[model samples]
Target chain A: MPTQPTDQGPLTSQFAGDADMLELLDMFVSELGARSEQMRDLLASRRMDDLRTVAHQLKGAAGGYGYPMLSQAAGVLESQLAAPVRDLGEVAHAVAELQSICDRAIRGHRPAA
Target chain B: MSQGTSTHVRIDAANLESTRPLVLAIDDSPDVVRLLQVRLKSEAVEFASASSGLEGIELARRLRPAVILLDIEMPGTDGFEILRMLKESPDTVQTPVIMLSGLSSAHDKVTAFDLGAADYVTKPFDIAELRVRVRAAIRTFTLFQMLAQRAQIDGLTGLWNRSHFDRRLVEEVSRHARHASPLALAMLDVDRFKHVNDSFGHPAGDAVLAGVGSLLRKIVRDSDVPCRYGGEEFALLMPDTTPEDAAAVCERVRQMLEQVTWPRHPEHNVTISIGIAGAAKATQLAPEAWVERADRNLYAAKSGGRNRVVWTSIESPLQLNRAG
Candidate 1:
């Protein structure tokens, strides 16, 4: 079982001893990866509106799933995409950081016996 | 850490997905296209081929490939003419082109290089050498893009730093002025952030900043711009959002932050005070005026026992007001 931070929301504690935490984390990671790919495609196509939409979804989902780091990175990326023409490097960096966090979380959240 | 042979370049696997080198191959010879395609087939590359210079130009315009392999010996429109056309077209000029030719003469190579060909590869080229050059070109282009991205990003939080915020502000304000769209600015400050640093150290402060950053991202729409204005202070520019709407978003962020559990220091609760200002006809007012109004309201929140959202509007004569 994963140790839940006592100060966090009830959901965090509910998933602590449950066997479902691993599955939830895996689902979150897969979703983030897919969303990241979609954002990258939108950005490369110069479709700022689509990119912003995908990034905004990622930001919201990551936050709701308790992956605050990924959410923060996605938020920054979402804002950049919202601009008339986003600085590509800024978006890339934010995406890179988001990927890192998602990867780390996926690695850390292992199912308990 | 060896001299010129250093393989210090970190290949991020995630970026390699859509960021794979997009190569545009322009040659009249199908054989040459197949040969080059075979040589460049790697995990990090995608190839788009055009049999004529005109076709290449069209593909280049549409696909915006990262690099172009142009055969200088094409019949109707030779590589030089194509190069000229490519350079003339603003859309394709920035796309790097590599000249492919049977002409090994120094003069031909020099002319091709002078005509803005990134490099010249002689016909019957070493397949290995061609692969190396293609990789090098892609690597250089990617590096240039990374440098461009770094310039606009906030080094700390990786947010769209202040300069980008300023540019977006000017543009949004101009659009609002033209369309009379409502625009709101929310200036957020972490309540007692210095104390977080003092008690838990800078790492914990960083954690809080990261937390706040994520929280703000959650409550805003995709069209809104959230920026790290400066140390412990962030700003959000909400285009087409009314003051009431922006306040609702900021208030949600405030509540979210208040709920975040600080790692290793659960007792040290975090809170944010937001100052929101909006203009229905913001184009009439300068960008700084809107920001200043939001900042003043933020100050009001801080003075009035923090952890609340304060808002003001161009329509409201009331200096600035706070709500719990």
Candidate 2:
């Protein structure tokens, strides 16, 4: 656990306390690095649609996985991508911020049980 | 209500389906389905998943899962369209559907409910909350199942009642007519049932009837429908069974009953006479006429000898075989 709750913590799943969910949470954490890489690839290729799809999925999935901040970050990115007026700078900033959280989650993670 | 209701959900599990209810989750994301399977594992339910709308709907029809978890957005036909099709099909209409969506707007919720969804849960779900909702939906679905089925059952023997037999006879006849498939109808009567009642009292007579019901229930094929035709008489409608096959089954019932020794009157043996009428293609006569044919055969069985089976198939004249 870290001092800050949402943005600066050990990124432990809220479900870590649930004995039945430990394995599912562990599998999700193990897959985090690949998900991050997929995001990077989609962004690098300028496949905004595919990247937005990924963001939408994460927006739904992250909170369920007990990372509410990651869910919120991906949700913001998804909303920004949906906007008709393109804000390239804001979109890039959101992507970068989401990537950093993913980094923190991958680095600080310890599997429950 | 006259005890024609079947409280069979908790029956000895031999004569009815008692397996855990199935929960089907339809979502494009494998992770969401995987998460659901892990979260909802329990004694009361089993879990299955489909990745697309079409697969989900097809599975829904085939498995008749107790509950369906539908995702609103996907690559192919969306959840709303799938829900519409499910509602349209009678096979899946009664199953409880819970919509899973990323969109939580009141408009979306209202639309799902309008389309006959029992509940809606927005993603990122509180897993615990989803579990509770799923259980509630299963409760509703199974209750509906029991209420719909119990109406057709006979309370005394746990077999279908007379009215149900009549209705299903017509339905089966029409269905067989359409398909040009074989169907068999058998009329059975307890031989000297009145003698048992006169000597052993009404309770023993009732016990004999109950024992015959269990024997019929145990011996018949799954596709067969055995019913109490009223007092000392029973009927069985066998879909897709030929006259020869039907006679074989009837002979077994006759022989079995002839061998049963009443517990109170150990020396007394109960017997039944059965007459079966069948056709590969449905006979052109009304179902009542068909019943009369079987009744005539039952008369032959009783006159020829008690504890015997008589049968006739369409494309052949009235036939009689004396068998134990």
Candidate 3:
């Protein structure tokens, strides 16, 4: 098993047995994974407009799936991308953080006892 | 993994029933559409989706859905534009619309409401709240449908009222003129109906009228519009029928009425006199004039005998004028 991120702990006890919540978490992980890769490519190409759009979408989608911290990370990237003079390095850091969140989200809430 | 997770767009032809109320979701994102499909599936409604604003408007015009869930930030024609277009078209003017958007700004909500949206729901909505809103919209739509239907029908007889009949006559006349199709009109009145009310009570009179209304409803062809024109008077507009054919139909109805054993007054039977007019091809006469001709023939039927049909063809305008 992959080492889990310190910030994203194991699956919450409340969500462990609920099938619908688990499905939603799974969907969020998958969707975030796609957006993270897209953001990385857009940053490499210095496509600030496209990167901002992806960030804006992720900001809304993450919050909807109960990942408020991930949503805020995406929102920060979105705000920076909309700046008149964008910092590629900062945007890259945000994208990497987003990818980490998605990785942790997919790893489930907790390691099996 | 992401490719595998893409939503399956299931346009299930079998799920679409003509009688079922439709709920349309118009969003560019397939995820949102899929979410709506999943959420709305359990409701007593059918769900349809469009990925673009133009397609959404076209579907709205065609399907006339009970409620529209429109996304505000679509690519080309945004939600406000689509809402304006929906209000402009007569076909969809009355359809209720609910705006959906990720933008939760008060300005956006106010603008949506100002543009005549029935409700506004932000993205990441509470599924339960949306279900309640959708159910409420359906109720409103159903109530409007029932009220409109009730307005067009007579309460006592359960037949189309005089106002609806007149409107239908105008519409039929315009359609027949455009297509040059044959059309026929018939008018009937109960013989000495006042005597029935005088001898029996008004409730008995109403029963007789209702009985005749039921008979008219049962006897007319699907293409025929049977209406209770006024007190004890009924009219039928038969499309694609000639004067001779309308006369036969009227004759059949007259016979049916004659055979009925009056529930209130079985000893004395009720009878009707009928008059028919037909445009074998097309006519330049106004709708009122056509009805006047039928009315004139009805007078003839009453004068000749209270239990027969009188008819005039549009080809014999001179004879019609003389008879009138």
Candidate 4:
């Protein structure tokens, strides 16, 4: 089982050594990365519908896994893409912000001894 | 796994219909149900009325409505119980349910929202706002379904595709190995496909490919899967088929191509060289190994002469006989 990042303070503190939680978190990070790439591609192709779809999925999965920050970013991104008039620049910034937040969360939540 | 747990879930956003969106209205008042039904009639939304929270839960389990509008102030089996049950049941877990209640206090709304109610609509809910929330829930569900479908299908051919084939191949290979069943694979290549493009045109080449696709579909059994492995090449996976049987099938397909006249060149005919490989003996070989064997044989046929059928097992024997 691969190790993964988790929520800080209390929610993830108890499960810091839990290998299963770590594995799940690792999978979550990987999924986030994949979704980020997908968002980039969709934006590049100017596929707003596909971008919204991918962002919505990322939002749901991130929320489900207790990554509220990641989920919120994805949600903002989804709403931007879902809107009738899409701001491509805003979408791009949101995607980059999401990637950064995911990166930080992944680094911050490493198993604390 | 739990009973009825779907290994894969498919959601189609394109098929999302705002019309007749199923809403389970859980409230003691018949007037509330009537009001919602009348207000949403033009939206083509359907309503399943539940007088009590228990009835609401039962109806939800049976009907699997797109959204549930529950009033929190019900007498027995209050909205909270139904909400808890809905969250517990995997079937209803993902379905968005909005809590409708006279308790308009901010705390009550916060609690309901925390309990997984998609949205909290107070007793004096605006009809337009409720409709908007319902549409959003349905839209979210549809998006999830479409994502699931996209995960399974090959974006290119719109056929079963390589990922699906990879998963199926593992199971099929396992079963064949266990039962000692013959599983044959044939690798097919269009004869001088590159030359065809060089001589005629790319559009002509595409036509030839389309023709080959149709021909393969016509020649193979419905159970057999023919995949466009890549450009100018196709692969046929015939489960429970012997190498010799597969060879015959390939030969028949090749003959069919020979008869079909190319439109670009009236005098020219298209042909395909096929290589067949199968596991006649019981072995725990990977599916890719079998495919590789067939691919090697395909190259052999291509080099030996195009427009021929070559079986991997026969190669060594033919060479031995020739040596003798």
Candidate 5:
């Protein structure tokens, strides 16, 4: 919570153009707020295991949803949490960056055909 | 070539080769499962997901899905272990399984392959690539199934051929033996089949044989395996059926045979003489001996009359009881 995450530019998913994924993308965007809340709660409770699971899930899901950057941020947070030499500070910062991307992700981003 | 067999062959082939293949995904993460459901949604295949290994395996066994998308890092039984178990089980052994994992390590890939995984897809995989891979797996699986069915199916009778009969007899008998389940075998001979060929011409004889095959297909239970033993001879293997129950089935077929009016040869009624032999428990007799007993009873039926059923238990006194 101490270090503020810098903006990482626009957050339109690369898969926005894909007709099959557009519906799923909408669902993912709708769920982002709740997902962010859950991650924050998990981090607050110091539930590193549950937090890593959430990150791992997001890492796998976001990329398919066309948000590769969000997926990458989650993957970084997951890796930090999995590391044996735990840096709680770096882990906290990674979580912030992932959440920051989630916040900036605009709903109904037009497909780049 | 019989008129009815081609349709039966087509039906059997269609059953084996599903038009819309079922694809199963076993992932621990709900998000991953949901993404897969959406991504793999296509007209050519049905998608089912299980958030745990146990449920996934159960679905795989029940559906016999053409292809499986298995995730490696599951909670209870990991994908590698699940793959091993699936490969070991006969029911799901032929199903193509693609391992999905976040770990891109060669060691993990090697492990998945060693455990009998058909393909490996790392996490955040390209959507188009996954779709192509799944289609490829389904094509491979359905083709394999069709080839296997063709090998075992008889061209004329629409029943399993002799080779399939030989293999299935051994397998079913052994299975029943292990389970101590009641098992029966009926050896059927088309009475005066040579006369039909000599009198009504070869085409009429072919029609008669096809009729018998059709009748067998209609009469036998779904669990029963009916096979064309050879020309004018057939065998039906009935699992979990006693001599009495098998005789009832034979009698029903006989009655149905009376109703089948030959296309060209209406005057000549095609009759089948069935000889049924069964054991209370399959463990009592060997498969060959059991078949021999059924054949003996069939011989008795042929001698007793042209269109009668003869049945005898393996443990019964040396007497062939004809049940008309």
Candidate 6:
């Protein structure tokens, strides 16, 4: 399990004080909630293909939404999923790491008001 | 990373229409599109978005925007495929594309570059940096358009220059020959142009040339191509025109020149000798030969009188006059 970063300041600043940034941050949080749930369900069911699809989407989207850590985690998990032989333990670990990053980023960027 | 940030700030989606050159963003993520809209708005760049590669391709074809920001990952027709399509299309080939992807790997970057991306920007792009890149792309595109315009236009008369005229003549001649359609070539020379320069000064001579150039542009049909063939000489390539029709147009030009109110030589008048050749009379000959035929008639016009049109007769090879 990756340690959760205590400070949300860096993530919040990514919005750059723009209303469109806030909207994107809100969208990111909403999408993260849905995708994190889907990821957990897919991981628990051992559906590597579906789980990789979710990871790939996050890999492309997270960084654009100002969540680089989540993008990195998702990218790693996606690559691991692509391996011909995947270790269940490693795949589960990568999924958990991605989930943690998503949680932190969503919490940090979501609108305060 | 969300610390020391102000809350409640807003970034509206940039307006679709503006004086700025358009910057199209093709990304599956709505969030990225919004992000781009906000960041690029500072540069006064207009925004257009597409959610898929196929949609992007269609939008690109229609808009022909100044630049494209393309995402590498999409449901269908992915970024590389879209890039290939854009590069292949004649209309969109000149548009600069900046690849937006989360894949920061050297291989991915190299692949995008190889596929004709103008620049590859990794995800979580810096707004300031993106703005700079977009401006640079616009600058490059503008420079290319200006250079292309310069190449096809005459510097002095704003008419099609000799080279462009030749190219158009070749194209029109080939088409006319292939279709057996009517086409005519007219050659005109200012009478006593050297005397005009010697008497009044080069500026007056230039004014006369410019006046005639503008007049040719104004009087000719839309299908006619008027070009400054060389100093004191002008050529008109008229497609879908008969020998009689071409002579009429040339005669109008000759009369217009005689009536032009010269600023430098108000008391003096300018005159032009014109020669015309119809495609029906010279269909079997090459384009150059056809032009030479017009030149021969031009010589006849000059020799017969300095202010008349001498045209080749289709029925008989004998030269005829428009105003005898």
Best prediction by TM-score: 3
**What is the DockQ ranking, best to worst?**
6, 5, 2, 3, 4, 1
lDDT of 3 by residue, A41-112 (tens): 878888777677677666655555566667678878877777898777777877887777766676655323
RMSD of each: 25.5, 8.7, 5.6, 23.3, 9.3, 7.6
What TM-score does each model's chain B reach against the true chain B?
0.64, 0.79, 0.86, 0.54, 0.78, 0.68
lDDT of 4 by residue, B30-115 (tens): 43554555556556566667767777777778777888888786555678778988998977898888887655688988878788
Model 3 misplaced regions, further than 4 Å: A1-34, A42-113, B1-15, B177-182, B239-245, B279-286, B312-324
Interface RMSD in angstroms for candidate 4 = 16.7
lDDT of 1 by residue, A43-65 (tens): 67877765654555455344434
Query: How accurate locally, in lDDT, is each candidate?
Result: 0.73, 0.84, 0.79, 0.69, 0.82, 0.80
Better of 5 and 6 by DockQ: 6
Please report how far candidate 4 places residue B243 from its true position, in Å: 1.7
Error of 2 at A106 (Å): 1.1
By DockQ, the best candidate is 6
Task: Write candidate 2's Cα lDDT for B123-195 as tens digits.
Answer: 9898879989999999998898898899889888999999999999998988888888899999999989999
Residues B95-115 of candidate 6 have per-residue lDDT tens digits of 899998877889998988898
In candidate 6, chain A reaches a TM of 0.83
Candidate 4, residues A35-108, lDDT tens digits: the string is: 66666777888877666656654554454345667667877887777678877778788877776776666665
Ranking by TM-score: 3, 2, 5, 6, 1, 4
Interface RMSD of 5: 13.1
Poorest 10 consecutive residues of model 4 chain A by lDDT?
Answer: A6-15
- TM-scores, each model vs. reference: 0.52, 0.78, 0.79, 0.42, 0.76, 0.70
Task: Sort the candidates on lDDT, descending order.
Answer: 2, 5, 6, 3, 1, 4
